[model samples]
Target: MKTDDAERPNMAVSIGRLMLKNPVITASGTFGYGEEFAPYLDLGRLGGMVLKGISEKPRPGNPPPRIAETPSGLLNAIGLENVGVDAFVTEKAPFLETLDTTVIANIFGESADEYARVAGKLTDVKCVDALEVNISCPNVNRGGMDFGADPEQAAEVTRAVKEATDLPVIVKLTPNVTDITAVARRVEAAGADALSLINTIRGMSVDVYTARPRLANVTGGLSGPAIRPVAVLMVWETVQAVSIPVIGMGGIMNARDALEFLIAGARAVEVGTANFVNPAAVLDIIDGIERHLGDAGVDDINDIIGTLDCRRK
Candidate 1:
């Protein structure tokens, strides 16, 4: 594959230890192992790609009626459906290693020991650029709530993952908490190299005509344009509370939304629900950002990261 000259010129943009050509990344569970969209867009042009969440064992995931469309967003309870980490290594990782972009493996577990074991295994996989600890999945009954709703538990999970691997770890935060910033601070103290927020907000809807809930899971994570403002606000608050870099996502649709996250203190932004509406959204966002930066007279993209207009505490 011939590398695009535009993407090769600036390769020093840092996303954790690995430098990327830019700061635009694809959110996990949306991009799907970095190969599905490769035919439509150049994977090398992206800053990085976050693979779907991986577990110790395969997950069949929720049954049908897992997706419910809202006015301007989507409610999903896909239940982290994936082929498991071990299978991913043999089947997906080999192909991913050939790609030019950075690879971030999103991992999840039901307990700290499970997290440690998974991270330990990923450490041996050279294709993985980083490990994104998905501690905010609300679809499951056990460890999902245990780590996400409590700051102390969140920290323990992060600490365990960090101890199990040398790779940079990114803890994805949930917005369902009363004070999302508190959880971020605790995770940072626990040795998270970076943070990503806000995961979809919890929500549910009823089918008045059918007399049942719209989704099989009863409740699902809310994501899309409706949640953009909330995500921006939470990302800004988290940036204020922690010193580690943040990767923000939630209802990000265009360049403006992505820039809002960058200014709000996210070192990078992820495109999640937006991809379902437009498979080309990632490419469009990358172009839109170049135009936005040029219009702002900003030569360096990193200058806009964490540049919120407020009194720094």
Candidate 2:
């Protein structure tokens, strides 16, 4: 017998010290400084919102034609364009302070010291609940993906940020590496409170007629449904390899996709590119997950985390 969908389950979940009312979060870069989506949906309804990647200083980002559509995903070389930490705190923090939901700041930097500096800057911000270190931005020429791809560099960055901020630190991982679990373990040891993966896969598109790259950068991070499978696998593996919580995101569009990540091992899931297509996608996912839980007679969502049955045939 199936339970009625009208009954709501306990959807609250924790990632390290960050407690989300539900498991659905808006991925960084997809949701701008929490102001852009205000006209579309209630920011307080989301479990958490990871703001666009912020740097130590303002970034102009790459030139035009920074985004392109692929078969089932998007290629972007936006270069982590942002108003920087100073502007974000002065201009954006007030709005976020009014919201009831958790707000995680996604930050990037050119070096370990810079990462520490950025993290330190947000330490006194009352609205920022946690920090999601964006070490996996592939489109950037310096820092970003470079530190994430190497375990030593990744750990160093994690340690630096942890030392700088009292907020829970989540190191977002890059899938372009050969062994994601290796970096996961290192970050965990380096004192990362939680982890998020897999940041867009490195890819490129070309214009056959023009004999030129589709994006001006020649390469960019591929995101959306195309990378969901890879994100699931990495989340599954990283959860197994590390003790910290795992926040999963790649191509999550609905509750089913989010459930897949939870079952695979993610404690919470982030809606990325899907938000671009549907502003209400995050709320829909939250509703869908609640329905799924009620139908399954599950009173709590935590029971499903890393509950995948890997029995061999």
Candidate 1, which segments miss by more than 4 Å at Cα?
Answer: 1-12, 311-313
Backbone clashes in model 2: 0
What does the lDDT read for residue 52 in candidate 1?
93
Per-model TM-score on C-alpha atoms: 0.94, 0.97
**lDDT of every predicted structure (CA atoms):** 0.87, 0.92
lDDT of 2 by residue, 1-313 (tens): 3355455578899997689999999999998987899999998899999999889999999997999999999999999889999999999999999999899999999999999999999988999999999889999889999999999999999999999989999999999999999999999999999999999999999999999999999999999999889899999888889888999988998899999999998999999999999988998899899888877888899987788999997
Candidate with the greatest TM-score versus the true structure: 2
Cα error of candidate 1 at position 94, Å: 1.0
Model 2 vs. true fold: TM: 0.97
Give the distance in Å from residue 64's predicted Cα in candidate 1 to where it truly belongs: 1.0
- Candidate 1's TM-score reads 0.94
lDDT of candidate 1 vs native? 0.87
Off by over 4 Å in 2: 1-7
